[model samples]
Structures are given as structure tokens and as C-alpha cells.
Target: MSPEPLQTGRRRRFQEWPNYRWAVLGLTMAGIASTSFPITVLSASLPVIADDLQTSESAVSWVQTAPLIAMAVGTPIAGKFGDLYGHRRLYLWGYALATGFTVLTGLSWNVGALVAMRTLGSFIGAATLPASMAIIMTVFARRERALALGYWSAVTALSPAIGVAFGGFMVDAFGWRTIFFIQAVPSLIALLAAIPLLPDTARKPEVRFDVAGAVSLGLAVTGLLMAINRGPEWGWGHPLVVAGLAVSPVALVVFAAVERQTADPLFPLEFLARRGFVIPNLVTFLGHMAYMGTLVVAPFMLERSFGITEVSRISAALIARPVGFSVGAWYAGRVESRLGGRAIMIVGALTMSVALAATGASILAGWLAGVIALLFVAGVGQGAIRTPAVAGVANSVDDADLGVATGSLQMIGHIGAATGITIMITVLGPSESSERFFAIFLLAAAIASASAFSARWSPGLGTARSAGAGRRSRW
Candidate 1:
């Protein structure tokens, strides 16, 4: 063979630049963590916010609800749009909007304005979620995909912890609004960093935007989430709850019909129908349900069953979960290439199942140490499952569909978390008994076990295929 051309060698070396991918990942992680600050801070500062605005707690709660609904609706739309347009452009726009909105949120004069501004900001910021993932998938080859996802998972799992700690300090020092100001700083930094570091994906100009499908899907998701969130407060049988439940299904049906008629559907039914795509997402939903349900129920169980009333102690015990999550996520990424995504997910799910079961046993036996340890194990399992599951879903889809596919998976997972919390709360009921706590944990365990079984059907179950080759596999 003739000697390799010098220009070709230089091009190959440039393509293999190690710092570029890491820089992209770092910027995206900062953006993700910064955006999440509002959620945790808002939850912590609710009492202060309500008092400052001279509003009832219920009314002030809308600040959180508005963003939650906006995120759920906006995520898929952003993902699909990014797929059609360019993800880099959408990402930059998202950060700019987020930074501006955070500043506006800090300056809000009333509850209603705060809610509206936060909702708009979150809706725009939601674009960054899918766009960042799409960029990571495009830049990193298959061998490194799981590791990149692992770091992504770790940052996500760790962000709430960081937010809570810093938010509490800011709320105490400068008041609730200061947290928003703090949030804006990082977002501005991420936006500036992304401008120069992020790579642009080729735009599919031929793909038509499905306005009807987007609207229908957004309405459907909003209705369903609203019903779930308000069911306990309004009573599941309340007229509004019943109406919301009814509307969601009707909207979903309309969305399906609209998608069928669209030239470039927001959600491709054929893609969703595939076993590779569907099964991993199913596992994700089940796993998050179990994880979130247990997390919400644990503090109550600790206070009532173990009588651990100290806020610091409770916080310390809860903190272990995220710690475990960070460790497990990092480790999963390191080993995924060797063990494969399916195996890692299966193991992760089973670990969570065991942790849930142990939690139940610990509560029943009145073992505080056991409860804390089990909580950590559950967190680890949750983290492990997430990294592989996300990577698996990304690997299963074509390059064009990466954004929407990942967005849909995250949407399903959030729905699962909401559903899980609702169901667990119902199980706890108007009681403070160990028996009820045990029941909740056992139910979570069952859900976790089911998630493990579902992992069996993930694409490339035992194979060690590279990213490029994985994309060519049968649906």
C-alpha cells in the first residue's frame, strides 16, 4: 500500500481530539445542573416565597407545577424540533432563554408572574436536555458512549443534592430570589461555553414539523400529569380530576391519528413499535417508578417507624442515596463495554429489587442502620440502571431520531416517577404504621423486579457492538 497522505492523517487526528468531547460534556453537564437548581430551590423556599408574596401555600405551589407541566410538554417538542433543525442552535437558544428567565424569576413581583416566567423559562430550557444528549451521542463513538452517559447520569443524580445545599444557604442569606440569581450565573457560563465548543448536527430541512401532533401530544401529557399531581388534593373522583383523565386519553388518540397523517411525525409509531426501543424505555419507566416511590416514602417511614425526628439526620440518611447513585453510575459506565448494556441494566434492576426488599425487612424489624444501607443500595441500583438504559435507547435508534427517542424515554420515566409517588402516597394513606410502610416497600420491590425482567429484551443484549455497527442492527 502507498504511504498514507499527510492531510488525511491530520484530518483523522483532528477528528479524534479527546478534549473536544470532554469540553462538550462539561458544558452540557453544567447547563443541566444549573437548570435543575430552580426545582430543588423552589421546593425548599416555598414557605418563604408564599410569605413574601402574601399568598397561600397552595397558590404559591403553582410556581413549581407550572414548570413541571411546561417541561413535560416542551421536552418532546424541543427534541423533535432539534432533530429537524440543528441541535446546537436549539441548545444555545435554550441556555440564553434559561439565563434570561432565571433573572426574571428573581425579580418577580407577584406569585402569578413568578409562575408564568418560570414556566416559560423551563419550557425553553427543556430544549437543552435532548439537544445535549444528541450532541454527546454524535460526538462519542460506541465504545465511549456508555461512559459519557454515566457521567451525564452522575451529574443529574448529583445536581439535586448540590441545589438543595446551596439553595438553603442562599434562601437563608439573601432570600428565595437569590437562588435564581445564582442559577443564572451558571446558565450564562454554560451558554458562552457551548457557543464555541458544541458541534452542529446536519439539519433535515425536508422534514416537516407536525404541529397537530405536537399540540395533541402536549395537551395529552399536560392533562395526564395534572390529573396525577392534583388527584390526592382534589380527590380522584373530583369533577376536574375525572375530566382531566378523560381528556388525556382523547387527546392521545387524536395525537396518534395526527401522527399517522403527518409527513414527518413528532413521534414515529413504527420506531416506537420496535422491541429495541420499546423494551428499554419500559424498563426505564418501571425502574424510575420503583426508585421514586421508595424515595418519597422513606423519610416518612424513618420519622414514624424509627422515630428519627432530627432534620439533619433525616437529610443525612437521604443523602446516602445520591452518593450511591454517583458511585454506581460512574462504575457502570466503566464496565458497560465489557458486560454490555442489557446485562448491566439487568444487574442494576435486580440490585434495586433486593434493596427495596431489604428496606421493607429493615423497617419491619426496626433496624435503622439496615434502612440507611438499603437506601444507598437502592440509589446505586437506580443509577446503574439509568446509564445503561439511556445508552441502550440511544444506540437502538438511527442518528436522525436520537433526540426524540431520548426525550420520549425521559418523558416516560418522569411519568413513572409521578405515578409512583402518587401510588405510594395512597398506600401510606391517613396512617403512620409500619405495616403500611412495609407494603409500600414490597410494592416497589415487585416493580423493580419487573424492571429487571424487562431488561432482557434490550437491543444488543450480550453483544459488544460498536456505536456505528449498532445503528445498523435490525429494529
Candidate 2:
């Protein structure tokens, strides 16, 4: 017999292996993290970047903020496109384009150039979220989705913490440009692996793409996110912010009208009515407001309230929450079968809320240990809810619309994060008073508590029920 037949047989068996999905998960995550980790790494070294480029820290912040805003606006559209085309194609294409932009980001000569490159990279890279989620969901069995999503959530949660943990050191040792340059290598490797390893998803070529709906919805998200993002910076009364606020509702109304009239809508209007779908998104929105709000404030609190000046100590403290989040998400993914989604989410939210409230007290009392511990607990709480919530949303939607559903969820979460960051900063203002820190954290706690309360409305489907739903929804 020829060796060619033997080689073909081995390749077929490898593809048929059940654990191949894990390979898919690992590679795609590497691609996603490669593009994303740089932004967070840059966050820690904004002062360095600003100084290098002859600009202010505030001006350099656009390197982070603009990319976030771009991702918020672009993700859903990219997801819808992925569904119309194929997720595997989009994942590879998006990452490949993003890798090129990552290199450009490293080579940027000025702040404006860096911001533009990063924003464009993130905007195109946004496709990876829905595409990766859809791919993983397709590969994993229904009962296994929670665990898969849990690991996915853990990576997403931990990457930023890891970036912040090492970002400052890397910037000081190697300079900021080298970071982006190095990031591109992993992305390129992932793109290569994906060419053969990732499974091709079924595409819906017959369905007419919803151009009008996509445009109007994109406009609406852009307007609303821009308003929230810029309102604090430019002042709420700034004409551009006001215009953004004004445009959002009108664009939303137009989007609703377009979605209704379109033959193939970008998003299914009926999913809005699903308790499983809506509640997780609502909880995510509120939870992130607290989670990210605390993240933005902790460094400042350490300096102002705790009087801690060491960057290493501050970085160590800042890493606690996301590290906690990574652990909680990992644990939740494993036990979702026994504890159920609703219970886990409620517990997570309540835990976060209580921890955040305690954090405020810790800061006021200047107990650095307590503050670090509380932040870690807050992170765990947020992480615990994320995997179950994402898995729940995936189970509720049809297999074909998984990308759109997950994309929309991601977009909402990003919007919530931006809003939370903005609100915390606004409330904290320039005052170094511990009382101001306390007030802002309490506000965050209240918001988190509201999220906990909202979780009760979510579907209580455990792994079994979710599995049943997944079977019924499969394309």
C-alpha cells in the first residue's frame, strides 16, 4: 500500500477526534488574546507612551479608548457578516488583518498614528469574538459548552490582568513598540494553525444580508457609546456629546424600523423577549459597570487614599481582581451542572456587590490588605457570572445566529465597561479624599446589587436543560 493512503487515514482520524475542539479553542483564543493583550499592556504604560510621543497622558488614552469604542461599534456587524459568510473564514481573515495592523501600531511615528492603527486593528479584530464563540459552540456539545465558555471567559478575564502585571516592566525594559511587534508573531502563528485546524461553519448564502439594519444599528451603537465614552471627558454638555446622545435614540428607532422591514434582519427581534437572552446581557451590563469601574479607580485609590507610591505594589494590587475573576469563572464553568446558572449568577453578583462595598470601606480605612482582598473577591464574583451568562445566551439562540447573539452580548458588555469607567472617573474627580473614593465605590456596589437582582429573571437552566435547548436549536 502507498504511504499516501496511510497519511490520509491518519489525517482523517485526527480530524475525527473529539478533543480536536479543544485544539480549536486554544488556537482561536491565542489569536484573540494576541490582538487584545496589547491594549491592556499599553494601559499600564500610557505615561511612557505619552512622553515618548510628546503628548499628555490624557491624549494618549485614545489609544485604549478609541479601540474599545471601535470594537463596540463593529462587533455585531462583523458577527452578522460572519454568520452570512462563515465563522472560520472571518476568524482567519480578521486575525490576519489585525496582525498587520498590530505591526503598524508598533511602527507608528506619532500618537495619532498609533491610535489610528490600534483602533483599526481592534475594529477588525472584533470579528474574532463572535466568530470564535460560534466556532467553539459548534464544536463543543451542549453539556460541554459551559465549561468551554468558562475557559474562554477565564482567558478573556485573565489576559488583561496578565498584561497589567507585566506591561510596565516590559515598557521599561524593552520600550512600547517592541510589545506590539512581538504580539504580531503569536497572531500570525494562530492564523496559520487556523487554516487547517478550525472547522468550517455552514454559511447562509441564500439569506439576504441586512444592510439597512446593520447600518442603523451600527450607527445607534456608535452614537450611544460615543456619548457615554466622551460625556465625562468633554463634559456632558459638549455639543459632540449631546449630538451623540441625540443621534442614538433616533438611530435606534430607525434600526427598529429597518429590522422589521428587512427580509433577513441582522439581529432577531424575538431574542429580545427571551428571558435567557435579555437577563444575562442586562446582568453583564450592570456587573461590568461595577467590575470595570472598580478597576479604573483602584490604582488611583492606592495612590490617593492608601498613599502607596510604588508602581510594583500598585500593579500587584491591581492584578488581584482579574486574577480572582479568572478563578471564579473557571470554577463556575465546572460546577454549572450542579449549581445551575441562575443561582451561580445571583451569588456571583451579590458577592461582587458586597465585596465592592467592603472595598470602599477598606480604602477609607487605609487597609491595603483588605482592599486587595476585597478587589479579588469582587473579581471572583464577576468571573463566576460571566461563563454561565455567556453559555445561557448561546443556548437560547439558534445555532445559525450564535455569532450575532454573542457579538451583541460582547458589544453590550464593552459599552457597560466604558460607561462604568467613565462614571467612576467622573464621580472620583480630582479629589484625593477617601470619602470621595468611598462614595464612588458604594455607587458601584449599588449598581452591582441591581445586577444581582436582575439575575433572578434569567432562565434557571442547568446543563441538562441547556443541552436540550442546544439540541433543538442546532442547524
Estimated TM-score per prediction? 0.92, 0.94
lDDT for 473 in candidate 2 is 34
Clashing pairs in 1: none
| Candidate 2 local lDDT, 1-475, one digit each (tens) | 2112233354456679877889888877777777666555677778888999999988898888888888988898899988889997788788888889999999999999999998998899899899999999999887888888888888887887777766667777889898887788888887877776777788999998888898888788888888888888889999989998999999999999888778799998878767878888999999999999889888899999878888777887888887899899999999998888889999999999999999999888888899999999999999998988888888888789888988999999998998899899988889999999999999999999999999987766436555545223321
What are the lDDT figures for the candidates, one per model?
0.83, 0.85
Report the lDDT tens digits of candidate 1 across residue range 374-421: 898999998998888778777777878888988888788878887888
Q: How good is model 2 by TM-score?
A: 0.94
Provide the lowest-lDDT 10-residue window in model 1.
1-10
Measure candidate 1: CA RMSD.
5.3
Top of the candidates by TM-score:
2
Alpha-carbon error at 48 in model 2, in Å? Answer: 1.3
Task: Please identify model 1 stretches exceeding 4 Å from their true place.
Answer: 1-17, 309-312, 461-463, 466-475
